[model samples]
Target: MNSDPNNQNNFEHSEYFDKENIHHKMEPVTAAFIALIGIFIFYQVGGAILTILIFGFNFENADINAMRLLTMGGQILLMLLPTLIFARFVYPHHITQILRAKLPQAKEVGIFIVGLILLLPLLQSFMILQNNLLEQISSTFPLLKQLMNLLDQMDKLLEKTYSSLLKSHSFFEGSFVVFLTAVVPAICE
Candidate 1:
């Protein structure tokens, strides 16, 4: 057999380790905890800070399109970028596998489309039912009256904001909203 250490033929005969990969450098649980902390810090807390910096304390007067753009930026920069960099450090050799960096087959895509189409109505109905149940429970439990009132106030504010975000005046705007609301989350998640 050839004796060159770097040769492919010697792989079976010799134990090889890629020193560049941090696969054995950290415990899996430690790595996962670090990842969670990183996500929370950069995406959750940082996104909130960034929003406050740009939009001030009140979210009421923020422009809808700009808010949508900021949300997309947070997904890409604060969330996706850091996850990618961390994966590169800890899983350089298996980066693609770590990130699921592969296109699905057409059949898989079709099945996902069909599943989403069927699930949409069920999801909407569940949301409506949840709201109705919340109303009934709040009345049955007087202690929950204040909590329900708070929710009702916030719900009205949120509904107006979400309605503006979801509305589109033209086809291009609708496509952008779809990318912002759907495609970005699908990829980032």
Candidate 2:
């Protein structure tokens, strides 16, 4: 054994826990590209899952409640998986730091809720303007019109899915649906 203070132990001088001095094997640009690719692939996979579950099963041929459940699963995959992968894999060491995951103060939470409520109208206005602009552009361009039509159909499908999900006869059923659709996703994200 070495008789020097620097040679006290192999683990003591190791760079693994020395995060400040750590040099990641993956470059920032490479990590970003990986994240983007992961997001794109996961989104497509989620969409494919939704399509197979929804159209393949033929929701109209079965119970709408079942269709709603399938849609909820798809939504979970779409919203959660990519986020988790990007957080854990792309930035493994700094997951919480990257996500800014921390418990906010009550005042901060209240402010955030109030800010969101105030901003809703502005967001809606922006969406309305965007839709109007797209419509105007679609009218002038044939390809754009087709794209817009496709988007419109998708929107209608989403509305129908939401309706199916929200159509609850009992208070307990409604509460469960709200918790599933809103609370769970909010917590996951």
Top candidate by lDDT? 1
Query: lDDT by residue for model 1 over 1-189, one digit each (tens)?
Result: 458955644543433433344354466678778987988687989988998899987788898889999989988988888877877777767665445344566898999999999999999999999989988998889879889898889889778877888899999999999999999988875
Which one is best on TM-score?
2
Candidate 2: RMSD to truth: 8.2
Q: Pairs clashing in candidate 1?
A: none
**Per-residue alpha-carbon lDDT of model 2 for 98-149, expressed as tens digits?**
4544456689899999999999999999999998998898899999999888
lDDT (CA) per prediction = 0.80, 0.70
TM-score of 1: 0.64
TM-score for all models, in order of appearance? 0.64, 0.66
Q: Check candidate 2 and list the clashing pairs.
A: none
